[model samples]
Target: MKLKNLRYSCRHCNTEVGSIPFASAEEVIRELQRAEEGNGEHFLEYDDNGSMTVRCICEQCEQSLRMNPDYYALRKWIQ
Candidate 1:
């Protein structure tokens, strides 16, 4: 069986932030189920190839957002 990997990327800049690996597909499913039960906000996406992607802000974009809180209202920064 192929191992499932969780990839994290910046939502605005599209920078690859981090990744988590699962020993098996079952492990990945369990984690996803747990996440669904939790109340915290999480960005989860399933790709056509069966990989998972999580959208999050990187350090640089986080700093930018802190400087300009208005950017949070926009889905993505055009510049």
Candidate 2:
């Protein structure tokens, strides 16, 4: 059986962070199933090869957001 790969990337800059190898996606799938409608969709993406990509903020963006608290008010602050 093909193992599932979990990839992490920065949501703002779209930079790939890292990845984890998983023998099965059962646990991950279960947790995702319990997430609220839009919540899961916003952070998770599935690949045709059965891998999953999670979108999260990176350290640089996090620092930027911390420095510019007002950026939080905008929908897209990176641009």
Candidate 3:
């Protein structure tokens, strides 16, 4: 059996938060497909090696966003 990998990184800063090894992609695909309608593309990505990279916000970025809610108006907030 082949192992599947799921890498989580911060969308704003590209900081790698963590990774998990999955027995199969089935579970991950199912969960990602359940994402809000057409917005699934924003969260899921397949790398060159076929591994999945899940775009997510890290703690630092999340805190920054909370401190500066206006940053949400910009497409890329980190400056």
Candidate 4:
């Protein structure tokens, strides 16, 4: 099997945010590898650049990002 670079979708919000900034497919994979088979609590999205937009979301995260636009960093999920 190949350790392919994967695009991750936000578990909370359906947005396009990848993981180039986080670096390494392994780095992203490690975060949610233990949740379950095919159930990644976190994810990485992709842009036209082939870069990724990483996202990890629980119910709290969804509510936090949605309720407070002030959390500009969280805008990643809202997208």
Candidate 5:
């Protein structure tokens, strides 16, 4: 399964765009389920379908998102 987004907005840069992200619905569901279960502590917002709906910026944006694993877990808790 492949996950593609027709539109996305960068979480940091707010750049809205149509882009094809790393494709894998199985991976996404697994990751989401993991996070939702509070068992996964890695953050790859770009690696998921919901977040992929927002365009991921370039390597420069990597700095901003790299430290958010805990935040991701918190988000899952809230969700």
Candidate 6:
């Protein structure tokens, strides 16, 4: 099996944010374990092709969110 990493992008601005590689099943399990231990704010998705995607906010969006907290309630700001 080949490992694949799908980078996350800002849902509003389409900026690349972060990535996680599923090099092995164990690695995927480890990530899940870590997520379960935390508050589980991060977004994760799995595709039928075996790729994993981790959604996160970019620095610019972070600043925008800090400046305008109301954007957090919108589903999409740029579209």
- lDDT: which candidate is best? 3
lDDT of 1 by residue, 3-61 (tens): 37777888788899987765545566567657867742467666765567777789999
- Tens digits of per-residue lDDT for model 2 on 1-79? 2437877899888989887776555676557646635578888887788677788898999999999999888988777
Model 5 global lDDT (CA atoms, 0 to 1): 0.46
**Distance from true location, Cα of 13 in model 5, Å:** 1.2
Instruction: List candidate 6 stretches off by more than 4 Å.
Output: 1-3, 18-21, 24-29, 33-42
**Is candidate 1 or 2 superior in lDDT?**
2
Location of the lowest summed lDDT over 10 successive residues in candidate 3: 28-37
The C-alpha local distance difference test score for the whole of candidate 2 amounts to 0.78
Q: Any idea what lDDT model 3 has? A: 0.80
Clashing residue pairs found in predicted model 5: 8-55, 9-54, 9-55
Model 3, 1-79: lDDT tens per residue? 2337778899999999988776645687558657835787888877666577889999999999999999999998777
Model 6, 1-79: lDDT tens digits are: 3436655777568677766555535566456547946854457655777665556678888898899899878877655
TM-score of each: 0.70, 0.74, 0.81, 0.32, 0.29, 0.60
lDDT of each: 0.72, 0.78, 0.80, 0.51, 0.46, 0.65
User: How does residue 8 of candidate 1 score in lDDT?
Assistant: 80
Query: Model 6, 73: alpha-carbon shift in Å?
Result: 2.3
Tell me how far the alpha carbon of residue 5 in candidate 3 is from the true structure, in angstroms, after superposition. 0.8
User: Top model by TM-score, which number?
Assistant: 3
Which residue ranges in model 1 land beyond 4 Å of their true spot? 1-3, 24-29, 37-42
